[model samples]
Target chain A: MKNKTNTKKGLVKAAFMSFIVVLFLTTTNCSSDGTQIVANFTEIVMQDEFNTEGAPNNALWTYDVGTGDNGWGNNELQYYTDRTENVKVENGYLLITANEEEYNGSSYTSSRLLTNGLFDQQYGRFEARIRLPYGQGMWPAFWLLGENCDEVIWPQCGEIDIMEYRGQEPTKVHGSVHGPGYSGGEAITKTYTLENDRFDTGFHVFGIEWTPDYINYYVDDKLYNQITPADVTGEWVFNQPFYIIINLAVGGSFVGSPNAETVFPQTMLIDYVRVYKN
Target chain B: MKNSKNLYLKKISVVMAILLTTVISCERELSEDAVFAEFGSNAEIYTDAPVGLTDQFFTSFDPNQGANTQGFGTDNNEAYLGSSSIRIDVPQPNDPDGGFIGGIFLDRGQGRNLTGYDALTFWAKGSTTAIIEAGFGTDFSEDKFVVGTKNVVLSTDWRKIIIPIPDESKLIQEKGMFLFSAGTQSTGGVGYTFWMDELKFEKLGTIAQPRPSIFNGEDVVQTAFLGAPVPVTGLTETFNLGSGVNQTVNVAPSYFTFKSSDTNIALVSERGVVTIVGIGSAVITASINGVPAEGSLTVNSGGNFDLAPTPTRDPGTVISIYSDHYTNVPVDFYNGFWEPFQTTESADFIANGDNILGYTNFNFVGNQFANPTVDATVKSNLHLNMYIPDNIPANLDFLISVVDFGADGVDGGTDDLRQQIFFNSSDFVADEWSTLEIPLTLANRSHIGLIIYENVNGSPLTDFYLDNIYFYE
Candidate 1:
């Protein structure tokens, strides 16, 4: 009878251990599907689902060109091509690569896509999942600009950069705001990093919660920076409508020109974009 | 039982001690202001008195004066005043856009007319970097005033500041008093400490006007007429006035051959006007060998020439380089030359009728010198200038004065002044008008050169039009 009791007790212990293991794996693996719902977002176009085909129906995109340097602060060098080679769907992902070649006086090329004509929102939660490229000079930015460009030019139009990673500092990402009282060289920025290896290893979600009184920037779910509109003397740049933009700039005054150490054909893999209005 | 009783006594004593300390500390913090007033026996305290007996000087920053209150727990301190007897405030305003923004200001009813005043002055104590800005308007916008900024180090001391009122011919009709201030929006929109007192306004003196009409009567003729690009030539063409009614085709040479050897001055054509972009004298000889007539042209260092006809002016107004009664020349050699003359500093204007020349000439010049260094409230530091075309004679000397004729307060009036120089044949050629870009560089006080004809001494009767003038950048 004592031997039978021992067996029963041992079996009970084994079952408890198995239950703990299952619980651990289930919790850890489940979070990877982006079910972690970082901050609620108002609008987002996940580029991951379009890996098989470019964003279905070209849902969120606007082409920009012709105006030259005067177009978009006159800092970029591409004609913003829609050609698949410039931007393409491959391996179940939208790949944006920077190329070094001659095109209409400006050398080096890239693609810039915007949700300007497609969607615009005043305030809510905004988040994007992106994997950045690494090298010496690549500048990949996932940001937003005011949609009122005809009435007000850039900077004055307001810009909120959710994730701006310059390859020079491979492991860090910057979130910033550019507007009237503070823009161009006067932009405000803050940097963040992942818990483990640099962000290039895989996709990471970047986000921001934009409300009337405060703007909270986030990495995954970690809040990093907050700015109130009243903190500045200039008009509130965030009060109006704004749309999203994603691009990889080659060389610019702010982000030093790409160097030989930099590698080309780097891809920013976006898992998904989702928005929730509050 | 005895041990337990001892423990209870110990706990009660400890509680009583804690209660006593908290009560004492709170009372002391609350009574700080009372102690501060009496703590320093050696410290001197001055009573608040209205400055500028005419209520021109009111201390709005001092709580003791009863004119205003210091928000955010701030109190009046005598140390905030300046040695000049201007009241001062060292406010500790806390919240952004919520704190007590303090300053001693002068009131000129609605606005003060500084019609006759020659200069402005005040005293200041710098707590961090401070500014002694005097605005001349009851309202913040559309007023012209001067801000004398001083970067002061923190100290338990005092210093005086004096600002020279530049171009008093325009500022005196100031209908406002001085402003001794701290906590401007520039200080991170936060609080700063500045002490001022003994506000005094003394007329330093008037600005003397320079003599005008320095043009030496030599006519400058454009050797090249307005036309298409051509091969190099040795002689230039001249125009002929038809003498009789039938002399319609009394044609003259339509082109001139310029000697390549005299290429010291590079001449470019915009429409038909010939611009000399060189420093040395180039002989642009246009010789009509048959009649044997000759004219000489000299180019000066860093200068431009205008061949257009002057604007029609009021017949009686003295027509010289500094005449306000006339308009600017029809053309602006520099963009935005009309900015300085307009009543409104806003860069607003309608693009008007097309000029005989293709370029669009707005009735008003666009904005120049985006940020100015003077007062933005009382009087605009607008030294208005108009371009005038004068007929060149052998040699003539003229007088130029900077004068103003306006109301002492808000009533509008005229204030004018002229800077004089001499022009000789060696300086500028005649028949063609000379355009002098004023306030030469982006500087507050720039060089104003006049051709003071050292030889001739009378103003000529020939009419010249002045148009499109401004403070050049």
Candidate 2:
């Protein structure tokens, strides 16, 4: 068994090296089409690979506890706590797990991790690789809110959803932008459907290239949607800096309540979160 | 061993050969200058350029005609993109009469095609924080037909300014001037100097057209009592195009064409005002730009106040008093007893096959029957059909109370008896209709009045409809 494991590791390493060589060669040469042949790379501004063990880095992440009124104003049913069982870092990944338990007068408990007051940026490429949780009432999201959230509140503070997946719709994810006029059900959103496999089956890279004039959404390097100021009814408020938030919500108005078929102890594994700038 | 080594060498050679051939073929197609350019550089890529202005005017704003008083000069020291930028010195706010007005006018002779372009992009920096008003017009004269105005803030650091053209249709093949003006009044300080560069028009993809959401007034059901003022005007018709990040467009009543399904029952004005003309039901529809929203309007006759039919009783048999039988008081009233509760007459989940009064615990008050006199000693049980909607929170506790008016004939006079009911018990099934019977003999009041329903634990209740409210043996 030891020999077999070593051989499997060797094979994986060789395949990864081959893929790198191919990408390097293709990116250097020009194609028949008139599309730009420049190398697609940017300077890394911030990154979190979750290489540490135990709790998240105190300097990078903070927690938002308790249930918001009306399920955090979304009719959600989970109590957020700063428990290790709900959020922990291990094996070079961050895990946000939602468990079915009676705690704090809620049927379930989860964690909401934020980067407010720690890290914020104006415009760049915001991305993450995540293995989503699946089952009815499971809502895991990697999104951003304006740094002025405490002062202006939601919608007015602006929100940029890099990736949001619902357990009920296992095969699709949503990218949306919310502001004062275009918030709630009226937010400017676009749906990206997985071609063959569900998002929970494996990790997928979700990214958004945000510029002053436009914001482009991508899944696995494939551009799926783009939004501009004209697409929205209100002012383009993305010019200001915004912080990040990651959470695994157990039942909200967006995902509805879980039924008998829905399983508990659903976990969302995040491989990394990286930001890049030109 | 020699053979195996040779095979491995051959495989490596084959892979290298394939890679080399692909690279050479691609390199052969590149131009001489492109071949020597630095690798992974985006500068050499030939992306699509802005329409009409192929020259880019990287050096200067050509044909720049404006008032000579405003200082304009070309500066090679500060450039946003290329080699040179335009520097303009603005006078102090109080320096010129009628406000300082200066601009750079660019006339292409023939109108440029700005159809695909949504906005003009430029980079600017000011000596101090100031406002720069820029726009385009048909001509340079005073009567020049200005298309739009863009009020942009210029900070000390360089920033990109995107000015959305108000009306693109006005730009089709017309002589136009791209202009900018800065003064003390607009900038709120002394006149300052500014620099601008990289003037171009960009198409930032197509804008998604969002469907409009129309809401008619506050509630789904609109109620107007008879003998009320004609043409009720408080009803508001609102339309939202996007989440309302933008200001919601308040469509005037004149903009909407109103129609009523039964005009004889309710006459609806163009502004969504429903005048209760008769005692009947009508559907009031308010339409704007072909989009329509409907609301049901029920006009109750003033003379007939009872909501339920009279119940028959035998001697010694307990008299059954239904909530719908109250005549002297309004169905929904706030007589300084509790928080106001909105009551709606609903046919859904009715126990007696007619209409039942449904209400939710909003503003802390539950359902209350004002000045209701019931002898709890005779009718020992207060029976009512309570239907809790699925949207209500689970494990919630509710209170049923009977307040005695006593000699004062007012609430909170002497005694009040209250009972608690847990929603999660077997007596209540969420999402389905159920019956609840509370014993009134506990109170046994001489003058039992003011039936009050409340959330015992003070938990928020969304929707709980009740019917067949009565006191019986």
Candidate 3:
């Protein structure tokens, strides 16, 4: 009987030890935070210098069937495609090129990248260093949208435009935010110029820091705009997880339809992306 | 018994420790959120007012005036040189392309400047209808220009329209005006009877007008501007020597004549700064190289002033509101107006209020005016309305105002101008309907309203049409 009691006590002690071991392992691997260190997950998933033929690997993005007949609400000419000419990673950078072609019903072709199912985050910093195209009618953008966008409409789901530009103004880049109350023409935006050559010549950094309180946009390290809680009056669509999107759209509403002056094969180059947390 | 009790206690203690660790770790993880920053540089805002044609401050609309020449209208029949030197017209068969043609030029001089003063106002009126159009160009070839331009719809009864060029810094300023190519090029379109009058350029007055170039001599004027050299600094240094750098480039030799190389006496750098290289003094043509660009420079011995002085005209004043708050607001008749209405789902009425324009010069009291409402989002057949008061006169003059106020009072305000228009009411309506079609270039996605004040003689009437006013950047 005494022996039986001893065995029972020993079993209980063994169970307790196992539980403690598992708890310690979890704490060490995850730090004090609940997020486990994703071995290969880095802030930047892709970068292209346009120095080579194709864009970086794993840059597989999706197309949005725009709000209207045009590709999205922009009424842009270029249709997003998976072809190497539309997008490629080479020469140490990623390139989204707009070429004159017939695809879907549009006369122009380009590539759009999105981390939709590949990578997404609830709240984090995202940025892309890119070089813009020149001339009239060309448009380039790096932005973010809510992950569950299929269920929700645009602007209503919220959009964080880290960078946008037109070929007419080859030297300047704009950062903005759009939502239900302040979408489209009323979007909050600020412009920044390039430090080196024109945007078409070399790559420049375009980034955004989105949080519950505010959103900060930058060109290189220069902070051009900040969107506070007060800036948003509609649904707090930004609170949910969002994925990254990179695209080069042909002429649409803001830049107007591409005219004859606009040259084909306009390219946008993207460099590395890095993210840090406190 | 005591040992068993102790064992149970140990088990409980371990469990509690594990739970505590798990909770703390989760809290820590929350702090490590991801955020990102953008990259780029800032361009300096050039607010300095330009003075001479030799100044590197203008970009020409057409560099190579080829076959069709840089004119207005569409591809098939453009408005080229007409019998009268001042007019460019659209050949009949009026399609979208072959309409009117106009151009502006910039002359690269001492400074790397191409844009113009902030405010640009001109006096223009149509001989026939109130429909006139305008666009900016960079090259003479139809392929290199910004086409599909719409007019501001000026009055046929002799009125003045003023427009403040947007982001002058973004303009190819070397030498350009806000170019207008009026009259419809659409098929079955009635030819244009409009004539643009007195176009003038003025410098925006600030603390001190940046000092003008000190001298104007046959010899290249030596200058030391305050800022660093620009992208295209010197016309002589940048151009190919084989292309006539050793000859004189006429500034304002004549309006429509293509400049020719005489003695290789003139040279300019890509920076736009010019230098007289040889002896003979020929007119050094200065030109702005982008849409609505213009430039004139003449250099000769004995310091002869061959430079054609810019025409003088009235400063830019406001025009009448096209349409806003469609209900109970008066739309101008003499000036002519077009406001389409639409029905859509998002157009439901809310308690807060509708969009209204509010600039420093204008304001509104909350609830003082009843909220104007719009319909929901829809595809086709949706529309809004604007009413032109039947009380309009045969001849008229006025300014328009509009605003769209958003919730935070940040961008909501009046004075949202889409384009600059020039017209007269008499040409459109001798005694009957004053029909005019004007285009709103930057109307989408903006939060603002309109205000129309009649300076000559008029009163507010409540009728207008509107539709499909959405927001976009």
Candidate 4:
């Protein structure tokens, strides 16, 4: 996905403070120029707090099962299963558990959940709060795929990876977009790295504020990267609706195969997923 | 159910609180102009053309010709800068004649002097992804001299397109027409509708060069099998006039002369096709009026150059879905079983022994393996042998999919399942047959229905082949 380094800590602290001030003003329904902030709270178009027990809400999620060639195009080693042992909800969170066990001729087992047909949206604020799993060869992602993927196929259908983390670099996450001229390793990507903490230590918010002409990525409300039409080399295909996907992969192209240091039964805990539109 | 009701009440209360706050703030009035200014200050301006030169092409414009297989009219519902845009509804296979399926013909009765203008700019949007060919054509007939044809991909949102015009001399005809032709649909069905607005010519400050820079393929090592045609199109580039305010004009490849550095290694045709003569390396170059673009081609011998093998499996009792064994059957097996759709069809390269289906440019072949239903659950894997001639360029990929129609029997319904597989030339050995074995367990193969072969990343006009497709336990 993204290939970024680290941001200066001093600048991040200053930006964070400014963000807090803006959030407070906007919530209070006031603008600095003495005018009312219209639509202070964007309408919630879709949400899943994962407060229920047992299975995830069926109305908002579906499952992609089986093992694909080269790990679903990336040469991944995990076999995706719909069973609760691999994917489930508990303690106000959705858990995607990856286990070091053989099943269906694969060396590992994991989960891939999607909102392919149940819920798809065009442009809005898409965000998720997640606690990542750590280890070499672990790959976790929250991404979007165009709804017409079946008809137009990928790259042509467009892809937007809001957040992707490779376990080898536990402190950084990436965001990227893939289309006709730019796809696979050639996609437009940017990395966001934490200053002094690893992503697995706690939960962090990753999001994308998408508009007609721009897509701005954020980590815990701090803007990291922005992509515009000028950044694209081929047809700009993000104008159509896209579906959400959350997957935890094991031993794939991005992070390489798991080694002795890798642990078993790793989990990616997701607190919530929310979409807001104005 | 009780918890859901409680959650609903809590959400409603929060919304009510926000509404109450908004109502209270409404008492402090902001001027209507002030509110508009807040949102409109940074709006993008599309053009600065006076009302006379910018023809919105509302219904008032007369003498518009051509028929759409679906329909066409003035749509007041949407526009780029004005109150309306001309909409053309295109259906599958829209070509009524060799020209555009449908278009609005603007009569330039006596050509207005556009001496200072560098290009034509307009706003367009499509119901689906659409590639439209637009340019200035004289005579409106086969003998018309097209100033320049530019392909533009339109999205659902309105976007501006600038077509640079480098050769003004081609616009000498006193009577000319602005035309647009829709590209053939890659996918089947009802097709899509597109809208155009704010058509005008403008001077964008700098003038374009008379000819554009030649861009041959990137310099790299290439491999071609002994008996296969060398990948030549990758070594050739299309002529496109450079875009932007100041740019150069590109002459078509038809005017360019091509040659190979070593005739003993490879022979370059006038059309830029390089045939591998023997094992070695050669530099291929295309020159137009002395400007040249060069690329390297290497031929490697020793690969399976044999023709496609005859199917060893029996078709009668083995539940064969598609195979060349039935090619000569009298019932026309392809009538309802399989069909191919493509933008352009030419037989320049063969993918396999003389019996497989081949395509050029954006193409898709759909096969209805089982009309009502087929119990493929017993089949563990779906197998297909594909032959991508050396002529297909690198970095370009293709896709194969096995579709399960679910209970609804429709392609894209909610319950339908699709197993899409993507591959490139790197996935196979050059000049040899590659058999792809895809596991059919998770695709709900019990009710397997359709199979589709599509070209995704291949260069336009690159040829590919497919044969011996079936499923087995």
Candidate 5:
């Protein structure tokens, strides 16, 4: 993801976000933790409930096929394929499956879908209600990267991770952001753990509310974390048009390798992905 | 300064990428969550004392065969759970009137409704790491559903052992709650003490992926005769645990619902008894809880059976190896299962309302009686009824051999004696019973241990039936 700084980026987003906050404060609710949650973004610009069967929407999503150079540079073990076995929209859900198989000289296969060219938003609330798969070597994520990634290398273009989960830990998910100096292991990240429940057994909403100055992370209706320029150890690189990428990866630098007990054909189901803007 | 800053940024990019590939990977470890299946029943057998049991739960094995009745009690010093555990002291082989330790924990009331449970779980630790045989589903009256796991090795540290019930659905009211027979076989006949705690039946959902097998999950094909029924062997079930450990337990055939593809050709009962009823091929398969097991029995029936000629020898004068009219002596096995070069299979079955030694794939087989070598010194002649099925081969030379283990009373000893006698092609009558009687010619008949029926010296005898085997004067 690569994006050059725009002169009017901060001023335009600050004005628009405050206007959305004033326009859509009709609903006030208390979360499970008794924290007040006011209606923030109500107008949906892009949404896929996966009500349509077969492949994902062609106009909205595109595939990243085959193993990337050195497993997307993380040494992941699975080949990315657009086959219906790997990814499909069925029964009102989008299923991203990581199967144990031999294809293209890789031991496993999965899918990665991105909206780089079709949909890119400058600032909004992006969330997906997802039920994740479990076991070791399962790394499924819903995140955004700058659309101008070809112009600037990663860490410079910036990345916003709304939800990143290690399947071995069924109860938790991590929210993170990466930029110039604060990237990879040093990225600003926080975790939200569910009580008496697991992400795999049920559907939970993972979202991020982004304005001009800061980003708020949420799992379900509970707001868990906020990251601002002051929180970054490097150059703040969030004022850019970023696109969504949803993927289920197997065995990478982020998740290590799967053991024998890890059952094959793990699946992550997305009930819906809705993006709302002012 | 701009050029130097660009070079520094590039250096950090390379270094951060290295961090991404190595140290970024982390695992959030989860604790063990052993989920038990929800069921209704008093699942506890013993926590500290025997739960839901009468005052005296232990029933000692018969004292006549060296069962030490006084060695079983509860010990409070060691327990996996609660304050006390069942402590058993296994007696040494030289113990007076008691050389072993074993018994059953009988239910004073009616049996337990064990259909809700899947396995009997207990924490066990031995004084010395010794193996024991334990199980349930017996009342010492009609051991109809007895399932014993032989050689359950105990550790020095407390380890939980799970003995899976073959079919819990069958145990609507099971009387026998626990049974254990701990001997000193592994400790070189030396006595040892073992303690068991938290013994109970639990429906552990983690004991999953049941792979029940017959004939060890192999598709075994053989020719069988009409009216002859073959019993299924090697009943077992393997489960993949939550920890990824594969634990296999010996199961009773009653656990499976045996099926014959063509019931007209053959029929397999719930007991896994496959009876050849017609002259066609039928595949026998089994399933438990609608999950198809891996093993199979394919039986190809050979039309009808010709009954063997009945022996007219007087029972008083005969020492029988196998016969319906006389009392057969103690015999070890019908087949020793000598590996590597042996192709003969022993599928002795019940035919025409009586048991028959039906040898199929009849290359060569041995009938061993070495458990108690028959002292046939007073006997004069050996008589056997042999019936050849189908068309007789041109070179049907059946060689019979008798082995006598001299003073050592064991095979392969220096004083062992053997005698081989051949009955040639002219001796057999095809599709009919041939009463062949031979004179006892072995140098020593005092300790006759084994009898072998084989085709040697280029003979090609394949399928045959045998009945009324005895040595008569």
Candidate 6:
């Protein structure tokens, strides 16, 4: 199956920002003319460079041990595991691998690392430098879930997907948000695509700068999307704190089933994850 | 010996430099400026007309093969891109001069440097939907890098076709612009128009994942003899295109960098020819652009080959089918692959000038010689040599059937007669040649057209060798 990467149709560049506003901010764009100052997030809150070569920093990260009922309600095929075979930190990167094999009762195994009660935040600049895997049925995502998820029903707690990629389209990634009436397929989302390049081939930065009023998406510091309270169909649940979640999920309803040609042992490598206070 | 040492040292240094990164993903290095001076780098072979090529474009196949030379030219009425397109009119089988159309387009100049191009792209359509075979890398003289894709199905509507180069870096100075062959066999010997346009080599970054293979991607272990040229065969490259088509093309050995595990036992050439030199074993492997091919060859050398005894019968009393001694008659094909049932393949080869018929994955195979039926009325016995290259199976039951097209001398006719000769397990020996001279079981031998060999009775015979077939009294 050939999935052409989504184009940059909804691109909203930071070049339109006022010169005075840009002077007080910093941008990552190497191009002099197209300077990007999406947000002023200078105060560092939490950061994981994945520089260690062993189990993740225990004090900062935790794992979702086993496959839940119906793959945690997404009907994902992989049995979540904490083993080094599925998740490990090596060579300055966090490798979350999805392997095709029988594990527990599931035919696939992968990892879901989260900072639930460990490090939760309300609004900030959350970003991760990652090099993703490629193939059908592979879903690697970096997103945030409401910290009060146990006390509230899912959409009631809110979700902000900073970066979510369908493995078949190596050049494109989607940034989205799910709320009360905008959950699952009804979520507000926008795609950011790389031109003449692919995320699976090299390292790329995926991030989101969020405030009480709006959430701006950045792929390699080029702001491509923004979602606000007005953009949601229902209640704006952004006031609550949310925890970080980075997972490599196998076959699911969003990406359909894996074909015979899908290569096994797909890995989503994360160089670092850093959150900053604006 | 000289080349292996140099290669070994180079490999060690390369492994040190790359360290532990993924080679498959990092092998794609950007092409820099070539050292060669002022070379022709024209990527386009045809546009409104021939790009860098000369005025004389189309070269038809040999006249003796019934290639209709007059049926090919540029047609302005039909073009997929420019003002005209290349149109080849495939003729009927009974065309007086030529029956099939095929040939190559040569770079009349000192050849063009196509190092930057990744694939040969073209738009094609047929008068009716037809299958066309096309590729490049064959300059007709060296024919070194010939890569051909078979069964390129084209519909009436114009569709683009892409044939990826095995390794673009190898085409430093290439003369072979394009190669194509079209026949009317698919159309039941009738004629059809095949049009191709916008022909050129393109840097289509879409062709990715070059999966090259030897022995058709199967890890093959074969017994070899000293002084025998055990040439590696079945070289191909399978690529996953941007359009989701997995295209596999037969490639030349020049595209690979061959290596032998133990050079003392055997040595492999850049041409992918493996030479069995000693009594020990060696594994031959290859790689393209640092990516290792899928298959390998483990050759177990058995000193020198022990030749089968030469036939001594008088030539007048023999109706030879195949032999080094006798002049054989015209044979149609060595293996008629009866699909859906038969699994055997003719892995035939020549070692030290001796032709050997190798039936690999053997289950059932056939040889037909029906252009003119063989009249073996005078000869009453069939003589042939058989060698079990591998271990002889315990329940080996080999059967040979000789078919005679009775009245009309036509195959599959109602009056066709057949004869069966069987060989039990006791008649075979491992690694030794056995001569089978079976007496004729058929009453009529005047119109014999086909010889079929099959393994039956729960036999596990898969690979074996054959030579010196003749019918003699």
Tell me how large the interface RMSD of candidate 4 is.
Answer: 22.1
**lDDT per residue (tens digit) for residues B1-473 in model 2:** 69976875796678666656666788454333232211110111011222232243221232222233536666666765555677778765445332354544443334455655645557889988887676554244432335333356889998876554433444454334356766565566577788877766555432111122223342244333333322422222221111111112222344355677777677766535556567766665555445454343344333222223244433245444444443222333422233124332222223323454445323233344444555556666666766554444655666666665565545664555544444444566654556666766454465555666656565566455565566666
What is model 6's DockQ versus the real complex?
0.15
For model 1, the stretches where C-alpha displacement exceeds 4 angstroms are: A1-48, A77-79, B1-473
For candidate 1, write residues B347-425 as lDDT tens digits.
1111122121111112222222212111112221223322222335454443322222122211123321233444444
Q: Please report how far candidate 2 places residue B210 from its true position, in Å.
A: 40
Residue-level lDDT tens digits of model 5 in B1-473: 69976875786678666655544453642223422232225678889888877677788899986798988999988877557899999988879858888888876677777887778989999998998988887688867677768758899999988887877878877788888998787888888999999999888754555678888888987667787878887788876544335567777777788889998999887777888888889999998777788889888888777667667777899999998778899888887766436777776766676667877666778899987898889888889988776567887778899889887889886998888888876887777888878899887789999999888877777667788889998
State the DockQ, from 0 to 1, for candidate 2: 0.02
Instruction: Decide which is better by lDDT, 2 or 4.
Output: 4
Give the winner by DockQ: 1 or 4: 1
Better candidate number, 3 or 5, judged by DockQ: 5
Compute the DockQ of candidate 3: 0.01
| The best candidate in terms of lDDT | 6
Could you estimate the TM-score for every candidate?
0.31, 0.34, 0.34, 0.35, 0.66, 0.82
How far out, in Å, is residue B400 in model 4? 6.8
In terms of lDDT, model 4 sits at: 0.66
Q: After best superposition, candidate 5 residue B2: deviation in angstroms?
A: 80
Looking at model 6, the pairs that clash are B66-B98, B66-B99, B67-B98
In terms of lDDT, the poorest run of 10 residues in model 6 chain A is: A1-10
Write down the worst ten-residue block by lDDT for model 1 chain A: A34-43
In terms of TM-score, which candidate is stronger, 2 or 6?
6
For model 6, residues B233-286, the per-residue Cα lDDT tens digits are 889988766554568899999999999999988998878888888898889999
Error of 6 at B252 (Å): 2.5
TM-score (C-alpha) between model 4 and the true structure: 0.35
